[model samples]
Target: MTESLNISIQFGGGAELLFDKIKKREVDLPALKKYLPDCQREKWTIRELLLWIKENLLREREELFLQGDSVRPGILVLINDADWELCGELDYELQNRDTIMFISTLHGG
Candidate 1:
């Protein structure tokens, strides 16, 4: 069984394009941007991103429990740019060009 859904994603580059493919049921994680360079950081792949959604995001798990995990707003997922926890989390209703940005928030000096 395959379900079709579309969500808004931010961060520019290929995120927008990727969302289009997603709406068509194309599960190409970072479809648009296969490699997003970040100065001296490693670039994540489309495959990797999709895997993450299936492994974690799409997974039905505890709410607050994930808050303290590494995929939280400050560590993995962005609070403001990411999905709304109360709404549906990964299962949230995605619209055409909604806007989802993944950020690593931190409190450092």
Candidate 2:
């Protein structure tokens, strides 16, 4: 049997506005193998997590949150308090209990 992956998600610096002003969330993701038949890997990556968030959590303005399968520029992504860029960005495999944060750097003047 496949197990669910549990993780924490946070939005900040105006990014929360896209998620109904919610700053934090606890998400349980389904097994990758079962969730995506084409996926051969046993682990979840930030890329998949972003897709999941767009489908399940993002409230509106998807264009503002995502761009061509990744987060739009000006949004900073952190995994467990470290920059996602340091963690390999979309290729970084997600671990149970990992805390992922998205902070928007763009703001209208």
Candidate 3:
């Protein structure tokens, strides 16, 4: 049987605008070796997941959602309800059924 990583991704605080107003999505990501041949890592990390999301899930205006190799400066990331900063940020390894949320800190008053 093929192994899959199931995760829930969410957007809020105006971040949904970049995802076509879709606030939540369930994704089943193929194993790292199955999808990414150039990658040397076995486990999926937030860094890899961000790239995956940019390639697969992001619908439009990627600039509003990302900057360089990570989320734009004003965005906040959460992993399973805990601040991703405390969870190793981009180095955090993703787990099956993990919940990841991106919230944009920029919004009009």
Task: Judging by TM-score against the true structure, name the best candidate.
Answer: 2
Best of the two (1, 2) by TM-score: 2
- Output the worst ten-in-a-row residue range by lDDT, candidate 3: 1-10
lDDT of each residue in 22-102, candidate 1, tens digit only: 322323233223333232323332233444554534424323213432334443333246445544554443343444454
Over 4 Å off, model 1: 1-8, 11-73, 76-83, 107-109
2 or 3, greater by TM-score: 2
TM-score per candidate? 0.31, 0.95, 0.94
What is candidate 3's lDDT per residue for 1-109, written digit by digit as tens? 1488999999999899888889999999999988888888888999999999999888898988889889998899999999999999999999999999999998767
For every model shown, the clashing-pair count is: 5, 0, 0
Over all chains combined, what TM-score does candidate 2 have?
0.95
Which predicted model would earn the best lDDT? 2
Clashes of 3: 0
Deviation from native of the Cα of residue 33 in model 2, angstroms: 1.5
Which ten residues in a row are the worst by lDDT in model 2?
33-42
lDDT of each: 0.36, 0.93, 0.92
Can you list the residue pairs that collide in candidate 2? none
